[model samples]
Target: MLFSFEFSPIAVATLTFLLAGFVKGVIGLGLPTVAMGLLSTVMAPAQAASLLIVPSFVTNVWQLATGPRFGALARRLWPMMAGVVVGTLAGTGFMQGSHAGQAAIALGVALMAYAVLGLTAMRFAVPPRAERWLGPVIGAVTGLMTAATGVFVIPAVPYLGALGLPKDELIQALGLSFTVSTVALAAALAGGGSFETGTAGASALALAPALIGMSVGGWMRGRVSERMFRRCFFLGLLALGAHLASRALI
Candidate 1:
């Protein structure tokens, strides 16, 4: 069993990453969201988060480095990143304590909220004046959520979209945000004593199929209808989230 879990299926992991990576390749994100949602079915959220660390970090770093305005974006978003770190570290007890089972419920709720937001195509704009103060708050909240559920795509993603950046810069900004979240999450897990060797190795092993799936999905990107694909993806998340929450209750 992986990570000493009673029911860790290697095949399930292989297929989950493959599918998650395909979705990310088709879109620009969703790797962690998809992975955590699927993996938590057979294992704990903490275990699933452990498997998520390497791939999420690697992919986000790649996305972060591909941009041209790293200095500018870093300067603009540093406060948010700092807040993320603080929030994640501060909330580590949630994972390290007796609340492990409840984390699944939180993950479910997060996925459901995120899916609903995506499905509705809701848009918000953040004025430059408000960003100076709003960013850190958003980041901290995102980090706390990350620590609690290992999913970091709530307020942060929405906040980034509101920045009115050009498409490329926006993509880069998301990369930066996600990269920080991944690192902060890693720190939180490590502090909680959950980021062990076996977890790291399993996470690393999952990377190959994820990358392969991403390659295939990237090749098919223009051929398929992205709008339709996204709908299906969110719908799946909605269902998965419901299942997770309900299962936790049971």
Candidate 2:
């Protein structure tokens, strides 16, 4: 049977990658964050995740590698990374059944959480001692949340942002975290037999649009104040999340 989904799966996937890529180019993150969130509006979480696997992994790897401190960050953040891996695998199990409504709701929750954090302008720092204990816990939650919703920001992004790392260090750290979660999510989905040849092929093709969009967004980045764009982005997320949440609940 053909892989059935809403909104012309290819059309949805293509636009999603393009838009998500542009956002990443502009903001330096959100390939999966934007892809999964918007795609979830029209497809199941599992399929959205599968579509996400390739583009997210490749870009984030680039994001991590170019940062000049992967080794140090890896050494420092290993516990959280490990926890993300484990948590992603565990939560991905729920996706094995691939419940669309549940997946939609989970995505909605993740989107809302991200938007709320982004809009609030609330920022704080975790003391180093507390990070030792809190990092892994936060990672686990982020992993589980990503697995369920296909949106990996939520507490993870907020928590990481709160850690008071220098600007470059924070970017690398996020890339590291996103890389781990993407790999783990891929593993879980593959293990569950979610990818057929057609779906996998389409996912591979999505990288094209994603990369193109990223390039455009990248070009626009230095030309604009991302602060205003980010606010608009989160507001959009808030609206999309509310729509999804309502779909799930009502």
Candidate 3:
């Protein structure tokens, strides 16, 4: 059976990926974030999550490998990665079956919070000494957030942003974190029987448009003002979040 909402699922997925990919191409992040925010409107968050896995994972891996100090970054972030996995697995029960609506609500709240933070341009400074203990905790919380929502950029993104890494390092760190989150989410879904062969195939099919969008976005990077684009992106997220939250409630 075809997955149909008001529109054809294939059309929705293709257009969503194209736009989400474009956004990511223009910015360094947001493929999963954008995709989840949009796709969740037409389908359950769990279903949206399954469709996003392949594109998110592949894009994040590409992002993770692009910059330097890969080994050092991985070593530094392993604890947090482990924490993410643990938290995600622990929280996976809340995302399946009858709890999906609650998960959608959680996703909405997370998106709203992220949008507010981005719009405010708030910055935090985490002392280097604090990272050893804080990273895992942050990871755990982020993982929980991921399990509850299909999105994973809550405190994790903010915390990483606070670390004060250089530009390249920061982007790499995001890729690393997102990559782990993707793998963990996939595992949790598979364990719960949400990510089967059909979902995997759909996810794989979504990858092409995503890549195409990314290519266009990358090309547009030089021409577009990042600050302007980010502002627009956050605004879109804010509206989308509101709609999802309200829709879930009603």
Candidate 4:
């Protein structure tokens, strides 16, 4: 694994990761949504996903492991985790062909639509009985996207947020979701022969800036109002989605 001391790409990747962390720290979700969208503009979608795995894992682990509500989050989110695992496996295997760029674009557009609907104040009610299916459905989406593009978790977060859980619990749930999906994705990539030793090393090097960004963002989380953070986060997502859509179309 040769570490390219070429500072330019590293610098850009670091900055992007930091910004993504800032958004996640503020809004309780969206590290992959932001990071992958931006990184994909410069790096290949698979490369962007690989670069982000370590940082996302580290930061989410910090959030989940340190939180008092970890146990409750685990209990509540097991179904979603299972779904994420399944979806990730499916995505990694079937979605990893050379034609995946088109799929990434499609996924990005779908995410944009979801963001737009949220901006429009869309509403839906899950029947008490149907709620049992939510986790698996979301997990499946997250996993597939994690393997194919890395922004698939956006559709699930809003529904999870609407559940009206405590803030800490929500963060822990997000952490758990990210962690589980990332692990599954790593396994899938290995199984599919998509894991590259050089890329993984580069990704590890890029993790430093992402960690720095997470620290800064976590600090800001304490200072900013949740409403303001959420507003900014969604707006960022809108911009990211639009950018990706255009990239896909061009």
lDDT of each: 0.88, 0.84, 0.89, 0.71
Q: What lDDT does model 1 reach?
A: 0.88
- The segments of candidate 3 whose C-alpha lies over 4 angstroms from its true place after superposition are 1-7
- Model 4 residue 111 distance off true place after TM-score fit, in angstroms: 4.1
> Candidate 1, residues 1-250: lDDT per residue as tens digits?
5465434577788888999889888888999999999999987788888899988888888888988899999999998989888888888857545787789899999999999999999999999999889999999999999999998898899999999999889889999989988988888888888887777898899899888878888888999999999999999999999999999899
Model 2 earns a TM-score of: 0.94
> Candidate 1 — which pairs collide?
none
- Overlapping backbone residue pairs in candidate 3 total 0
Q: Model 1 reaches what TM-score against the true structure?
A: 0.96
Residue 225 in candidate 1, Cα distance off native in Å:
0.6
Best by lDDT: 3
Candidates in descending TM-score order: 3, 1, 2, 4
Q: Write the per-residue lDDT of candidate 3 for residues 133-202, one digit (tens) a residue.
A: 9999999999999888978898899998998889999999999999999999999988888888888988
Q: Candidate 4, residues 44-87: lDDT per residue as tens digits?
A: 66667777767777777877786678776777778888888888
TM-score of each: 0.96, 0.94, 0.97, 0.85
Model 3 C-alpha RMSD vs. true structure (Å) is 1.4
Candidates ranked, most accurate by lDDT first: 3, 1, 2, 4
Quote the positional error of residue 164 for candidate 4 in Å.
2.9
